[model samples]
Target: MSKTILYARVSTTDQTIDHQKDQAEAAGFVIDEVVADHGVSGISTELKEREEGKRLYDKLRHGDTLVVRWVDRLGRNYQDVTDTIRHFMRQGVVIKTVINGLTFDGSTKDPMQEAVRDALIAFMAASAQAQAEATKEAQRAGIEAARRDGSKYRGKKPSYDREALGVVVDMLGQDKGASEISKATGLTRQTVLRIRSDPAAADVTLSRWES
Candidate 1:
């Protein structure tokens, strides 16, 4: 049997995979597996290059169904997003989005329908990418203004506390999976990787951050 898989991504700690899952469940999806990549700049990182994304690609099969909250969840840019979708469609996968109940069927035979689908994909993907870039630019402007003021500027608060992050670090050091750590601590997989990249630094910064 084919599975219904959810893929979610967040650029900051303020975002939570649990919420996305809840939203999907509320919308009546019996999600079989969730693949998430956290703290990655969607505008910059292509989906295929992400660690969790790579895992997702490997896990998906011909008959599987892929679900996302939005087209942006698949990718930030138009070309990357469309190409990724095309690849999945070629493999006989069905892609669905939760927000508007959007479904992209690569199996459409009618020329008109195919053109419409392609055009829709292009529009949505472009919009997603534009939004990401705009948000990034706004954040950059805010940070620059803060720098000019010389104020203590922490962009967003950390999602995990010292204790929770400590557990994540411990689990990571034990070579636990990102999904495992994310589920245990409610931290995003990207945050897990960031911590794993430098546990000692994370510990020190988190310690100071708490104080």
Candidate 2:
């Protein structure tokens, strides 16, 4: 008997997979095998790079139906998502989503229906990618404006501050270790270590960033 498989991913580990499973079940998918990718950010990650995501690639065969919560769970950008979906469709894999009840299959005998499906996939994938880029740009602009004005931006103290951590970072540049910097600044060893590791990247954070 052919099986119906479900794949679910949450951007953060804090979000439980149960919710996604619930939605899939509510949508009437039996979910024979569930491949879950957790604590992985979809923005910077490709579907195939994820552990469970990779499993989906290996397990799925021609004529197998793959169900996901959404298309975004399948990829990072518009082109990647569309390409991945189309590749699977060509291989006789059916892509199904719970949220919108969207289904893509390769059994279409009508040229018009295939064209419509392709267009819809292309448009939706582009929209998803554009939305992700816009969100990142907005966050960056907000952080930069906050930094220039010295206004509190993300609710609590920033995780990284050039003004305060600069000295420690500079000391590290002079060959200071995390322990030495931690002792000098009265900061935790982990914080000092992180600063030492990514000083330049850390230096751009706002002072009011929340954990």
Q: Tell how far residue 102 is off in model 2, in angstroms.
A: 0.8
Model 1 reaches what TM-score against the true structure?
0.71
List TM-score per model, in order.
0.71, 0.71
For model 2, give the RMSD to the true fold: 5.9
Tens digits of per-residue lDDT for model 2, 1-211: 5567888777764556788888889999888888888777676787888888888888888878898888877865887798889888888899999978999987898999999999989987887888888888998998888778765554445444555587786888799888888787778889888777776656555433522
TM-score (C-alpha, index-matched) for candidate 2: 0.71
Clashing pairs in 2: 156-208, 158-207
Local accuracy of candidate 1 as per-residue lDDT tens digits, 1-211: 8999999997777779999999999888999999999888677788999999999899989889999999998888888999999999988899999899988988889999999988988999999989988888998998998868644454456777878987997887788999999989888899888888887877766655565
For model 1, give the 10-residue run with minimal summed lDDT: 149-158
In order, candidate lDDTs are 0.87, 0.79
The C-alpha local distance difference test score for the whole of candidate 1 amounts to: 0.87
Q: Number of clashes in every candidate structure?
A: 0, 2
| Backbone-clash count (model 2) | 2
How far out, in Å, is residue 186 in model 1?
A: 21
